[model samples]
Target: MWQHLSSLRARLSLLLVAAGMVGGLILAGVTHWPLPQLLAWLHGGMGQDAAAPTPVTATATTAASVPMSPQDLYVVLAVGLVLLVLAAIWLAGRALDPVSRLLRALEGAVASYRDGDFSFSIAANRRDELGKLIRMHNELGHTLREQRQHLAQRELLLDTVVQNTPVALVLTDASGRVAYANIASRHLFNEGRSLAGLDFAELLAEAPQVLRQAVESGEDALLTVDMDGSDETFHLSQRAFRLQGRPHRLHSFRRMTRELSRQEVATWKRVIRVISHELNNSLAPISSLAHSGAELARRGDVDRLPGVFATIGERARHLHGFIAGYASFAKLPAPRPVAVEWAGFLEGLSLHCRYRLASAAPERAGWFDAAQIEQVLINLIKNAHEAGGPDDEVTLSIHDGGNETRVEVSDRGPGMSETVLAQALLPFYSTKRAGTGLGLALAREIIEAHGGRVLLANREGGGLRVTLLLPTAKAPPRG
Candidate 1:
């Protein structure tokens, strides 16, 4: 009778009948002796106050004399208890049906949620507290589902950005071991090998100073490190941050060598074209002039001879100067770095240039060959002046760019077209009628020799901005 108590209905029925039987026994025992029986027993036990007793026969109540023994009483009580238990079980099953359904729904919903499926919803059949709770649980599932989807999409977008960016991206754990690497980082720092599972220190072995402070003390720093003897120079931006519940450092490397090389090649091609065109022009005229003077002298018509010689001399000098410029460009020597103050440098530039110069120089000095760097600066300034209108201002600004010195020369001239800007540094590709097209090209060569680069871009409103980046003494010197 007590075995199947798992159901709420069974347990309630069992408890109810057991309580009724216990109460009935207590009440029966208390009133078992009536007033007369109790008084008689007391009289016999106390042995007191008996007046002359009348001879009266004791009589029992009609109900007490009925044909009933202790067995009959037991049987009747058992029958009643069984009936009560059955009735109680039936009522409890009906009353607790809603609770049973809710429990089943909870079980199923939890199972679905565990499997990452949030579509399961518990039904709210009754307008009661349980119904409201069920509705809230369903809403929770929907909200969680939406949030999960949004988070996944965001993670995908972040991964795409990290993978596709040209700057090398490296993620390392608190122990400074590589945890993740983007494609650019793998190609740049890992010798095209996968960067995962490798130690960051191993990759930076030759250049441990690249992120020494950051690795040891979780500091932020900018570093220039060369990897695998590639001509490229990478500026490493490193810092510590939290990722995946643990501390990690992110290293982003931006390569600048390839860009500079492309600029240099374009400059050389332009130079060749300009040299060819100018040489052909000067040589053709000189050849014709020489022939004309010879034929005229043979015919005894020598009155124009002085003019012819003068013309020939002028053409020869022009050609000589053009060729000499080409030779100088071709024979550019390696830079001999020296320390120079910005004020003195700007003063010397002022004497050479007629355009008004604006200036901002860094407090710390630069490590560069003064003459070669001055050549580059002079070329850029001249280009800026020519690109701007007569009234336009030529501005020179310099800033300490962490690991390098950034110098910008901006002018207010009409900006170059895409086609012109793309090939502006090529030798023969010049907009001016008499331009050799070697100015920017030669400047690039010199700056590159000093382990720097030239960047030419159009100004926001109009005109051109030429930028030069030179490594400072603090930065590891480049080739």
Candidate 2:
């Protein structure tokens, strides 16, 4: 009942009317009622006959009483109630109007928040508590909106960095699941989806131990991993760091294959510089000594001259060949690539050796120049022939790989030692007694210039295998 009464406009109006009615009743009891009763008493006591009623008339002096007829009193009370109700209605509407407007604004604000519109703002023109609350809400919403924008931008920047970094980058979650990988990382790892979700330990099994140390210590780690099924090398850097309050591991990879190649070139240059200096120093004196010996022999001191002259001439010839070999390492010509048929090329190369074909040759060929490829083939074939035992066989084969043409020269001999195999391409570093150490190095330089690679590995059974990979022309015969 109280709840119903509290919600009723009429009840509120009635309460106001009741207050005014109580006040009017008090005034009536104190003024009109008492005075009338007192005048009636006075009239009777002043010798006016009590049996006859005193005549009353409507005048200013008798306006309060005139016996106050019941109908007139009823009309006065009704007028008073009506005036009180009108005042109550006006006062209530005036007091609650701002509240009703504020309630609507609050509803709109909530709806905006629900719809993810943080831009909505409330007006705070009043100096009341409601106004202060609106001001605070606006301030809070502005802060939250700014924070959301900052977080979004930060996320975008991180994504761009991961996608476009030059080094191969891989990100892993706290539990070691691969979460993201960049383009370079995919190409370097060589396994499609290889690093994704794979345990770091498994993915980096071939990596050096430093990588594990870095992860455990929460510091950057550096290690080298040899590419599987290829001769390429990579330098891996691993670091553990936090991203947006979550622990993550990032691995950066750089291909060291080219670095190794550059090192080989530098080492060869150093070797040539030293050998050239020494050979020139030695050859000058030997030539002079040979000339002096000839002069002495012409002057009749023939005995000493013969031994000295023979020694000088022989030493000069040896020094000449040594100098020639060193010069060859320094002066390899640039490759000029052109198309050549594989069958005819091999047949021509075979003319330089007394070799029999073991199988039918490939009909189609690739885009390697004849002169350059011939030099590479002869060096490899000669090495195979020299390395093979008398009864052991040497085989040369050509076949088509998907994007490349491969040429393999195999020799059945005790394969190269690990040390020799590792350093075989180094200039002036040869195992053969007669070798000047420039053959394999020159071959590698030439082939690389032609956009090809040379690989030396041990054959499955018991020999050294030299494989040449050359990029083929587009749209080659599929079969």
Which model scores highest in lDDT?
A: 1
Worst 10 residues of 1 by lDDT: 58-67
Tell me the whole-model lDDT of each prediction, alpha carbons only.
0.74, 0.71
Error of 2 at 269 (Å): 8.4
Worst 10 residues of 2 by lDDT: 57-66
All models, RMSD in angstroms: 11.1, 21.3
Give a tens-digit lDDT track for model 2, residues 1-479. 65445443545577567667766764575346754455445544553554554555522354344464465456556755665577667757755776777888888988998998888888758655556677888898899799879988999998788777768888898987777888777665545455667776566554545454544565453445434555555565677789999999877766677888899889869776667766766677787887888788789888788678777778778877777866765676665666788778877897886444555676666677788788778888788888864433787777877688888888888989899999998666778755667888888877777777889999878898888888886432211
**What would the C-alpha RMSD of candidate 1 be, to one decimal place?**
11.1
- Candidate 1 residue-wise lDDT, 298-409, digit = tens: 9999898999999999999999998898789878777778888887887887777755556566777778888887877777778777774654477788887878898888
TM-score of predicted structure 2: 0.43
**Model 2 superposed RMSD (Cα):** 21.3
